[model samples]
Target chain A: MPPPAKIRIDLNSAVPAYRQIVDAVRVLLVEGALPPGSELPSVRRLAMDLGVHFNTVGEAYRELAAEGWLDLRHGRGATVIARGSPAARPEQLQEFRTRLRSLVAQMRSEGVAPARIAAELRSLTESLKP
Target chain B: MNSALFLSLLVVAFTGAFMLLVPHFSSPRYLFAVTVPAGFRASEPGRAAIRRYHWWVVRAIAASAVIVATMAQSWPDLAVVLAMLPAIAGVASFLRERSKLQGYAAPPPGVREADLAPDGDHLPRWIALALVPLALPLAAAAYLRAHWSEIPERFPVHWGAAGEPNRWAGKTPAAVYGPLLSGAGMMLFLLLLGLAIFYGSRRAPQRTAILKILVACVYFLGFIFTGVGLMPVVRVPIAAFLVATFLFAAAVIAWGYKIVTDPAQPVEATLDQYWYLGSIYCNPQDPAIFVQKRIGFGYTINFGNRMSWLLLGSFLAGMLGLVRVAR
Candidate 1:
């Protein structure tokens, strides 16, 4: 596993605030900076840390949650859920299955073959498991 | 009921409908057409500045809703009500920001326009795409309607203040509507979710049918039972079901519009590629890059769509129940 990513906010960059947040979180997840089961800073705290509003952080968290990266509870704040984690119940599994199918379709359209895609997916799944 | 009651009901229903609709109608382009656009061509720096300002406005509006919700003496429904303004602002900001990013550089020398356009006869395909998700919800609705007698009857009612400070506040009697109306609302919600899924599947078409079916089944389970098995735990599933449905619906609408209006570019093309020098979707990417660019974030229209339906369902059920009780 990698170290947690250093969260950076580029005030001068042209990227939108939400995208910046998304990018930063993505970097952390990709880099293993935020390990599976790591608790993320509260949206309020992160917003204050980044000098952005709570909604910016919330939106970022919401996006992440939608993508299966973060687990969002009403007041518990966001927590990193490793990709392909086993935390999903039946319904959540269905959601993941749906997302995976979409990703597969997308990758296929990109000409990724089944064998190569399957291998890469297996590796990804291994990385996500506890 | 008296004319006054009828009028109040009509106003409330319309208010709910308008609240549900504001996002769809006052979308970014529509709002920008009313406000900015012409101002964008002045300078690149000016455009960037406008984009930043748009984000700030979105934040401010969302914050205002949070404040109002804090002060309001309504039910938990106020949060859903408050959420509408910011959600709309967020969408508007997305469009405005995309517009600001127009025309930094020209396209590559020999990029064929034909490669950009996916194919002809896309309308029927698109409509089919939209309808795919509808099947699950319709099935769920039909099942619930047929088994309406199996639905449990218990108010599980509580009278208290509900909102930011209190869970239930300023409450009247548990305004009961009949099981039939509640069932009907579930069906309506399923219908909306189907529409949303159909729209969403256009952008991401993996297991579109199965996902809809799964979502519908989960929701159907929540709607049919009388909170019997879970007791206090029931609300959690119910809330999740509603939230998921709403987010799913919104995703469908947003993505569906993208599919119908624009030439079907491959997924990887950024908004900058498709645009006509900074109009709505000018940016372009090839099919390969587009398909490969899944960073795990696509809009889920489930949250708002479900809430709107839940409230509508709850209200209808309550009204019908009130009539039955009165009769």
Candidate 2:
């Protein structure tokens, strides 16, 4: 059997741990590595494994539940759910465009050519496809 | 030679050998409890440190052996103190080596990884086997009750190395059943401790391995204490119990050695700064109550965690209660 899906977080990173957890799980979910109906470790177990406070994993799980990607029950652990793809709101689309432009600008400032940036974006998008 | 003197020297020899082998019992990534790069243990400085440590330990053991042999007959009680010389020297040498390797210490790994799959929450089915030893004490109690008249009015409760009685207890329920009760309490404690380690510690094969060892220990305690309780009715040699204890300890150490030397065993990533004296782990931020020890094969309590303090308090209270009942 293949190895179980794993998530990695850098404790020394400036980014908050909860945000890192949320983003890593979101990428795995998008890539279908974590399929619908898959169970997540209990908050305490994950927190201990990650060497973080319990509240950090709980916050990340709650965020995913709010995004409709997970179902959180009282005693049962978090579970991935089949979420309906809602039509992107005009404001949400605009926000994504703005964030994308800002990221591209930062990469360009670091001496990345437009062609390289576009190729990197294409590679990531291809990986996201189910 | 006096048997007591011989036993004391034997203990000193065993302790020295165990201490000399301590460095090899940890993961290769660690040297003297400091995290180092892979293959660093074979490096020149590492080789020098190990050589120096062995030199000090060997000298200490020789000295301890001489002291124990000389003092064992005249000061039998003091021989026990002399037997600790090698272990004390080992610790002092270990700390010295650890400080020397601080310059070469690898930066602690910042990234932590975990499987998203839910696992290790449930206790193993074999854990129920720990309960099997509980029956030994009960059976001993029933046997004792059935032949209450056969028990002497006063019988030896404590014995010397020569299999002679040193202490006696009267014929009372407390005296007759105390050892059996204490044995049951110990088994129960081991069971609860195994459960705690399973649920509170990070999931790893080492955790399960340690739990199995604890189960073995419970069985050992069960049989030994039951035999002691039946001493008034049975004439089993005291040397038999001593030999059994030594054999059981050696088996446990061998099993631990196997786990330690296994390259595939994953070591817990912990900051060296959080470890006090290279043994006492106190990481306040880490949610784990028990983390794998860098110096040994099993887990140690994270003294910084509040839950650990609570557990320690409960253990002490339980021990005090056990002592009171055994008395």
Candidate 3:
């Protein structure tokens, strides 16, 4: 078996610390870094190791929970739920499309060409490949 | 009690309370954790993103360790303080991410822009809260300035360092010039930072030019004071002046940057991009955590370096004085 999934963060990124955590956890779930049913380090343990606030780690885990990538129990820490496909409720799917469209529009307003945006999406998909 | 002293005491007490609250609130989350398996089975782009973030985080921690170690030998006290640096940064990131994830309510189909902007703004309150910490520090500094002589040249006897006491020689040439120039540099630094922030908040196009000028003024005056002390006739004072200059430069740069960018933006992060970037000194793109967005900036990193360096310079001067006394 591959080594246990270790989540790390970059202090210098333009992303917010909590967002970075969410993104990192998301990537782990999508890439099979942590398979479905895999257990994650306690938010506190991860926070301590990463030298971040426990809240920051907790927030990341919460994000994953919302996305259905991880299951958080009251006293059990976080466990992997769905690995590759985040279970999407019908309402959630609709919301996702709306958010995605607005996000794209925001990019376009900022002068990003459609081709470039497409490339970014393509890159994101490619990165998810197992 | 003096208001500043009272405030300072209050801050210490609050910080202590915060520390205690940590484990109580975080224990459950720490005890049980979960993660989805990576797609090594079909390894997709999503997997790479997570892997990348992991790598980046590792690198950031490693670099922080090296910096702390290298600077420690020269400034042991500062080094110890630096130890807490990574922990603060890491935790901040963790909490932020967790909150975002928790707040995630998948957008409903055709969700409008109006929905994205939550009603009854939460951001303003948070910003106000952030400003609260600054108040205590500023109040204390202001009080000290108003009662400069009462501020005590040395800290209380109980808190004194382990080494031999280094008292300022009465009526020394260096002592006269050292404080004067250092004080001036401090004032200039504050002015520049204030200007940067003030200008940045406005919509005027000329604000950028004003910021550039303010920044330049800080750098220029800082060196000027140091250079004045370096003159053959003023060598003794030069050392102290340089220490002050370093501090002034760091503070201005840190606060100045905050005036320009709001860390609240959505984008990739670099350590320098966030308003808080000064909190952690090194770059955040290390390989331990990869595929992360741009890093946010924090004042702790950049300002910490300046504060540490200032103390170091002061210590060096004290040592030199002791050597002269022996001679």
- Mark the regions of model 2 whose C-alpha exceeds 4 Å error after superposition: A102-116, B161-163
Lowest-sum lDDT 10-residue window in model 2 chain B: B158-167
Ranking by DockQ: 2, 3, 1
Better of 2 and 3 by TM-score: 2
- Candidate with the larger DockQ of 1 and 2: 2
Top-down lDDT ranking: 2, 1, 3
Query: Each candidate: RMSD to true structure?
Result: 22.5, 1.8, 22.9
Candidate 1: misplaced stretches above 4 Å? A1-130, B1-58, B73-83, B104-177, B184-204, B207-327
By TM-score, the better pick of 1 and 2 is 2
For every model in order, the fraction of real contacts preserved is: 0.00, 0.94, 0.00
User: Across residues B1-327, which tens digit of lDDT does each residue of candidate 1 receive?
Assistant: 332223223333333333333323322222222222323335575455455645555564546445544534333344435535544554456456546444333232221111101122122233333334334434444554555455345434332223012222111122223233344445445545444433322233332432444354445534443332222212433334334545655565445444322323333223223333123231111211111111111222222233335545665676666456422
Residue B248 lDDT in candidate 2 = 95
Q: What lDDT does model 3 reach? A: 0.43
Report the C-alpha lDDT of model 2 over B117-197, residue by residue, as the tens digit. 897788888878888889999999999999999999999898654345788999999999999998899889888888888
TM-score of each: 0.28, 0.95, 0.27
Cα RMSD of predicted structure 3? 22.9
TM-score of chain B of each: 0.33, 0.97, 0.26
Candidate number with the higher lDDT (1 or 3)? 1
